[model samples]
Target chain A: MSDFTIAQRERENVQVLELKGYLDAHTAPKLEEAFQSLLNAQRYNIIINCRDLSYISSAGLGVFMAYIEDVRKNKGDIKLSNMSAKVYNVFDLLGFPLLYEITKDEQEAFNKFAGSAR
Target chain B: MKDDVELLSTFADQATVAIENSRLIKKSIERERLVQEMTLAQEMQRKLLPQGLPAVRGVDIDAISTPAFEVGGDYYDFVELSETTIGVIVGDVSGKGIPAAFYMSEVKGIFQSLSALYASPRDFMVRANAVLSASIDKHSFVSLLYGILDVRTGRFQIARAGHCPLLHVGRSDSAYLRPDGMGLGLAEDDFFSDTIEEHTLQLAPGDACVFYTDGVTEAHRNSDEFGYERLRAAAGLADGKSAARMKEDILRAVDAFIENESPHDDMTLVVVKWLGLTA
Candidate 1:
């Protein structure tokens, strides 16, 4: 169950998904759905809080890749924060650092998005 | 009167022997039926492997898996995710026989369905781990190597979830890619993944990367284990060969090393080569 809760702030246009548990073949769908809902709602600027994100697989990364193009086309972006080294290593191997904006802390990710909007 | 008593005892003894023989025959038949079911299951498992590697430009892929009994725990799949990218997965379940094979099927379904949609190896593994942990029994776990090969760019992004080292054979010798991790499905949070290590080898165009299950390295010869050293040597000898040939070479070498002794466990191998770009 690699699922998380989403809290959106309309004023800042920041959508944050608090991810938890393992992200593998079985649980990837939940994340995919969260991503799609955010996209549908036009909440493009996103931050995925990985403080509780225990593990991630290629399939989980695929979800992010699937949505990146859509978010970018909307002139919005997805930034990840509080990623464990295990999760980060997965991103690094697939060249996620090049495609997406990653930050060390949630505040930094949020701040970056806030600054970009300004 | 003595003759009559002896004759009656002899007849009773003969009758008891006849009944026992009939019971033994029924038991033998039951055993044969069980063997037949197992054989069918093994055949089905074999069919799960790709008939041949997809003809992807700039990439060479081949794999083989042999069960110790009628069924095995190891499974591998090659998914054509896109025109240029190919998804490769090799996994081994905790145990052997039907239980492991069933688990392998579950894992395979996830890889097959999600590979078409997902792009990153790490993300795929994380999701898979959670689901497997939830569904599998407490005793079950898996070690896997799941990656996507960008044939156009000659780059592959691989994630290791407690599998064997993927070996890179170059002009000089073998260098193993040891990623951080343990087997999946053990715990929801327990994980180890590597920082994406990139090995660009345009200079060594014929170099090949080999992925194998522990059964190959842990094969036994009498009391001495076959070990990784022998497996590495065989892989080096198989360098620059086609994916199919490389797979064959490794199996043949293992067979020779053990001198036809049956493998104590399941053995699986996959080979990928950088064939340069297609003209």
Candidate 2:
């Protein structure tokens, strides 16, 4: 599958991974690479819009789980928005909603980011 | 003059031994390097296989997966969706080494996502087939057995994308369970949806289904493949064991049968036992 694409815009030092397609064993590596590159550059404030994501497997979920702590340690948070029902089911099953700040849309997520930063 | 000749001969013999020793040392170093490369390759291959079954209840599963040479294409894993439904996949990518290993990962991902949306094995194959054909290298394609096992019903809905025959064993006999379909990632117009077939069997107690890549059937002892007949015989005999034990036993038999012979491809095996309600 075409890996979820990542487009970046600097919002005072935040990087977002806009994920699409299926995030399973195959495409997880691409996400992992993107996260690695972001972390290497010390960009921690992360927002992942899973609007177009159709599915996510354990391996794909693992990438976020593995990096979330690092992002938080840098005084940054990882937020998710616009997750399709199928993808949300996977995250919900894994109890990820408990660990991360998930929002319904970009406005709410961006508001949370602004509120947290202050 | 006699003493001088004796000394000369002794020196010449020592020189010959010294030259041989140097050659041996060089050969030993080269051999060690080869072993090192082989081990690295094997490690890479091992990483491709899933470490363990997902923590999903209501499923009895076992696998015997071994990579040929350094890295081969065989892979198997269970993707846990919930306590009752588990998505299982076993496949072999076309080549060996890094390319096969990488593609195997891609296959795993494709199958996982397809599985998330589509419960029907045939539909899953159709979507994954289209995706893989578009993304992977044009020359690479994979033979796969993707299935969803209903733990509550003991029914396995399986779709084959040009894979080896899966066997259903019961009553001291075995039957082939394979979908007539093409491989994934091969053609632009390759119709996985139409070609995919689904077969359902209510796995009664003591009934087992054996899923494997072609490595088992194509295993060579001298020249011939261990083939489907021998595999059926092995499954029939494995009737009494648990799913995990049966998988081990079958792999052991296939391996022993092809003793002193090397398998030309990656070997993967998955055994599911329908342990119906206990008394």
Candidate 3:
């Protein structure tokens, strides 16, 4: 069984994906599939709630880089939220904030989507 | 006597079966040739690393790159930039085996050629990222830290491309130096250049400056990560030690943490100690 899992839910227009467990090279394809399904449905306003994310690796970040262009091209943006310090450290070190908006919590990210839509 | 005769009859039958299957012999030969080719590739990859560290005027330097059994890509190189300055770099490509090894060679060529042309660490990184972003796949990237040190003044200018931060251990205090920079190939040229940060520091005598890849902090025992705190403690143990001893200290710390676990990725470390300029 894979240690990583994604729970999908919708709150209005924003598609929230709650990521749990470890995200690494071994489980990156699972994340790729999640992003593919989201893109296929034409649902672009995305909020990735990383409250339960324990670890992340370069490959996991690659999955994000691979999909962000496509997601943005469709006029939908992916915002990240609720990352633990350890998980956030990985993003901070790699300068991920420049490409994706990271929020302190899920509500903050949801509010960002609302703000943009207005 | 009957058992011996039966055994001889079985051997004769096996010999006949072997003789009938020429394809089996040919397959075995192909497998043997493949093994030989893989060994040659491994040797060639090993030879790509620096034969030895080049001696600089007023600093002590040591480095070690240990490839895991599966050949994860970890590379380090040194270039003398001027009469008093030396350029050093450490990089790790994503993924493992043949593809990673090949990408490493590409990175090596790009860095070696570009480092001489651009003296500024920030400019070197921007050019490297521009080349890499236009060429490599979206999912593949290299994390690199390139630094140029002037031995005469003990001044170092460094830029990081999503690699581990530099570790500086003084006589009584030690910390990881964090500079703002993205990994190579992850973003376009203008965005990458705008986002990247470079820092300069003056190395004091008896200070040990360490540059390393993720393999050190990510090394684990079961599910427990070795982490940066442990890495800091390990390198701090070498505050006044030689560069070689400092390298050994960090590697030994990781080894003792992981025990006999076969590594998942290659580990690399390059240590530099400022000895002050000689009259």
Candidate 4:
């Protein structure tokens, strides 16, 4: 019933997820599944592209919280990018900017991953 | 041919009966699970509530938490720090059901234990945040607004952490009191400590303050949110009213606005009104 989707791809050895539509309680589990798969494959250097994401609730934020530790434990990072101001406000409200590396675009996030990689 | 037809009818009837039996069994199992969850949520909510708002001299206080069907983690508690001071908190944790209950209880415990140790509102938050970051999961955090109200002096010092703004209505003007702070468990000590600032309010006679979770403003009907403007207006309308009266007015407004829509999140509110020292 939730109008949400996640597109997963790998570029330059970084796992990138493209989120679309509303990411509320209904859609959080789908995001959780995506993260689970990536973790299973040991894909830690991740980028979440939120250009198409229209809304995100605390449930959606929880998905990110639930996984960040394992990703960092592997010395990998999850960087978010391409968030609209509306989407950014939700993250900012919770002080997520302090814990997550959020960039303006996917390219920027990828570049940071590249920089860290080198 | 007649005998074969009778056999087929009997077979079909048995199959239908078996299917219905299985369906009923599955439904009962699901219902059982839901009932268990609701009970746990209720217990958790009860634990979070104050046994009863104590009769603090010169102050009238009341709070409420209305859980949605799914039962979110909205928490509020009053800690009697001293004879004249009360440590109050209203907070919301992400998620619902058992997970929410666990996180809410953890936050309550952490805050409850620390309330006695720190008299300053800011110090309480800083210490609570440190403990939460270590104990709470990264995906789970609580947005808490903590205040130490000294009833004797009518001094209310408050600090926010990713919670909704506190609506304060005085004799002449009403404003939302929101000091800068992030939710607990989102950041470490240095960043959390840096971003948080404590604010103080001196309550005069006929002053009213409301602390609530997002469920109030976010309460929606047909995709239209209640919003901050409406909330401010609702509270302001009851300016100089008793704390209980203002709480009722706001609840009524929210209810009318939602209009047949069941709330999607837990709605919690705390109302405080100051009256001149009890004669």
Best by TM-score: 3
What is the TM-score of candidate 4? 0.86
How accurate locally is residue B76 in candidate 3, as Cα lDDT from 0 to 100?
92
lDDT tens readout by residue for model 3, B88-160:
9998887665776788899999988999999899999999998877778887888899889988888899999
State the fnat of model 2.
0.00
Q: Whole-model Cα lDDT per candidate?
A: 0.73, 0.73, 0.86, 0.85
- What pairs collide in candidate 3? none
| DockQ list for all candidates | 0.02, 0.01, 0.56, 0.59
**Where does the lowest 10-residue lDDT sum fall in candidate 3 chain B?**
B94-103
**For model 3, what is the alpha-carbon lDDT of residue A114?**
96
Worst 10 residues of 4 chain B by lDDT: B236-245
Docking class of 1: incorrect
Give the Å error, residue B234, model 4.
Answer: 1.9
Per-residue alpha-carbon lDDT of candidate 1 for residues B8-98, written as tens digits (9 for 90 to 100): 9999999999999999999999999999989987887777777777888778777777788547678888998888888778887765567
Give per-residue lDDT, candidate 3, residue B213: 85
**Candidate 2 ranges with C-alpha deviation above 4 Å:** A1-118, B1-41, B237-239
Every prediction's TM-score for the first chain? 0.89, 0.91, 0.97, 0.98
Off by over 4 Å in 3: B1-44, B237-239
Worst 10 residues of 2 chain B by lDDT: B186-195
Best by DockQ: 4
